[model samples]
Target: MPLARTSDLLAAAVADRRGLPAFNVITLEHAEAIAAGAETADTPVILQISQNAVGFHGGRLLPLARACAEVAAAARVAVSLHLDHVEDADLLRAAPGAGFSSAMFDASHLPHDENVKATAEAAAWAHRHGLYLEAELGRVGGKDGEAPLSAHAPGARTDPAEAAGYVADTGVDALAVAVGSSHAMTTRTAALDHGLIGRLAAAVPVPLVLHGSSGVPDAELRGAVAAGMVKINIGTALNLAFTPAVRAHLAENPAVTDPRKYLDPARTAMAQTVAHLARVVAGGGQG
Candidate 1:
């Protein structure tokens, strides 16, 4: 199946009360691994890339974006390609050109009204290209994807009340809210506020998106689904799963110079993690 729009996937998850997994694709290898996992698991997934990842790839979005589109187009199962944590309007404009069906405008670093205005403008531009727009309400502070440690949660989490206005005023298809998750936590032990999740779900009219979900434990992930999060974004966990395998393969076999031999192990590990996440998010047994 070809890639579907993020809004379509979100709507389906919302109606079914199952949280959809939106996995970040950092490279062409990541995209292939994700498509393989989703096809094998029979789960609809979102293949996403951050602005940070874009810069890392080539200081431009075209390379990874094209990889995402091609991967999604050839995938056996449903896949939606999205650009995430994008604050630059020009980048958002160039995103659809590389075949993104949806994107998130993360203006949380700006002031409140500024964030709102920026989000609205992004929504307008995204709509012009018939793309779905996802915007974050309050700041969810974190280091960029390539950074070492993401900032802690004291001042970065979302405020549900403001989230409602952000969604309504910006005309975004989905809203990413910070209930309690923090970014770049290598471990899955971050605490979440179920009450806040429910409140934000009730307050915001659009389907709720949970960012920084890599730090959230399995139980909390299920609780987030119960609390009405339709789309959940995860990255670091897969990185953890993939990186160790690649490192171990390289360490164990120093003579292996071919990238494929080591990368396949990493890809397999990431596929297993994706399967686990899909099942946990859906509250169902893996296929």
Candidate 2:
């Protein structure tokens, strides 16, 4: 299949009451690896590129976006190409031109009305290009570099009432709510409020997205999905899986400095993580 729209992928996940796994793509390897994982799981998945990741590579979104689109197109299962946690309006606007099918315009650092107005502009731009837009409400605590951080607990929580208003104002296809999951947690111990998840899901008109999910344990991840988290965004877990493998490979073979050997194993490890999460989010355990 070709690249998928976020609304299409998320609607399927919501209708089936399953969580859609949206993994961050930091490199071509990451994109290919996640694609392989979805192929293994036989389910639809999303490949996301955060603004931080784009900055890491010197702001070349076009090359990576095209590569991710290729990986999604080649995957056996459906794949959606998404830009995640983008706070910069210019950067968010660039995604549709770069061939992204979906995006999250994150303006959570701004005050409520500004966040809504900024995100609405982004949503309108995306909608104009036939791209699906996801918006953030209430700052989710944590940092994927510049992602607005909150001092409050990861589960410090967003008011579902305010969340609904944000959605209505922005007309976003999906909403990422703050219900206590923080970003870049490698410990998998971050707490999530299932009650908040349910409340936000019922209150918002669009699908509910869970950011900072990499910190949430597998069991808790399952519970979050069951609680109405339709789109679960993960990045740290894949980084954890791949980084040590790459380091070990480089350490062992100092003489053999070809990038492929190390990169290949790291890619495989990330693919495995994706497969693991996909199965959980797809609600296929005990099968």
Candidate 3:
């Protein structure tokens, strides 16, 4: 199968009022497992590679991106490749050429005006290269153990009016709004603002995305989707499944020096998690 267009998948999900799961790819096994999971669930999925993950792999994007593309192409289900949290212009430009259908140009760390300016430029360049662009607003926090916003922090949640204006100014295809979910949360206890999600959905012109969704509980995810979240980005949950399995494998078999022996179980665990989450997202938490 060829790589599916991110826009097409998103459009279909939007029409169906379902959430599309976009899982992060940190390693080749992650890509393989995601594809396998989507295949198992008989649904389309997006495999995303973030800038920080590229940094972890020696600042190279093509190697992993191509690997993900190849894995997606071989999968039984429709799978798209996306570059996530891309702040570097060079890396952003590299996406389309490296087999990505879409890219998230992150400028959320900047002030509103600056974020609009930078994201607008990136979106223009991405459009020119035939890539669907995603941008973030209201600065969802807590990446790599950074402190997340308090419940009452100023500008912590996305204002519908501001988000609409930002999307209009930036010309992004999708918007990741801050609605109380934080990135890299190990516990699935994060509460989403469903009313705010509905408001943002009604206000924004394009599809809505939920980042830091790994922290969100199943019922909260269903509520978010029902409220209008189309794209759900999940990363930490895969890590949570993978790392513990590897640790347990090592604990049980102390002399197992073969990487395959441990990595097999880790990949299996991630695949199971992806399958379940895909069902949960597609079925609106009915999984």
Which candidate number maximizes lDDT?
Answer: 3
| Cα shift from native, residue 116, model 2 (Å) | 1.7
lDDT of 2: 0.83
TM-scores, each model vs. reference: 0.92, 0.92, 0.94
Query: What's the lDDT for residue 137 in model 3?
Result: 83
Q: After TM-score superposition, what is the CA distance of residue 61 in candidate 1 from its true location, in Å?
A: 2.0
lDDT by residue (tens digit), candidate 2, 204-276: 8888888888888888889999989898888999999999989999899988678999999999999998898
TM-score of 1: 0.92
- The lDDT of model 3 is 0.89
In the range 1-287, model 1's lDDT, one tens digit per residue, is: 77688888888888888989999889788888888877777889999999999889776888778878888889887888898888777888887778888998877766666677888888998898999998776552233532111122434556677677667788999987767787787888778888888888888889888788888889999998998888888888889989999999999999999999999999999988888888888767632
**Top TM-score hit:** 3
- Specify the poorest-scoring 10-residue window by lDDT in model 2: 146-155
lDDT of 3 by residue, 1-287 (tens): 98899999999999998989999999999999999888888889999999999999999998899899899999998999999999899999889999898999988776566777999999999999999999888743445654434222333788799788888999999998888888889999888889999999999989998888888888898889999999999999999999999999999999999999999999999999999899889883355
Off by over 4 Å in 1: 139-155
Candidate 3 backbone collisions, by pair: none
Q: Count the backbone clashes (under 3 Å) in each candidate.
A: 0, 2, 0
After superposing candidate 2 on the true structure, give the runs of residues whose Cα lies further than 4 Å from its correct spot: 139-155
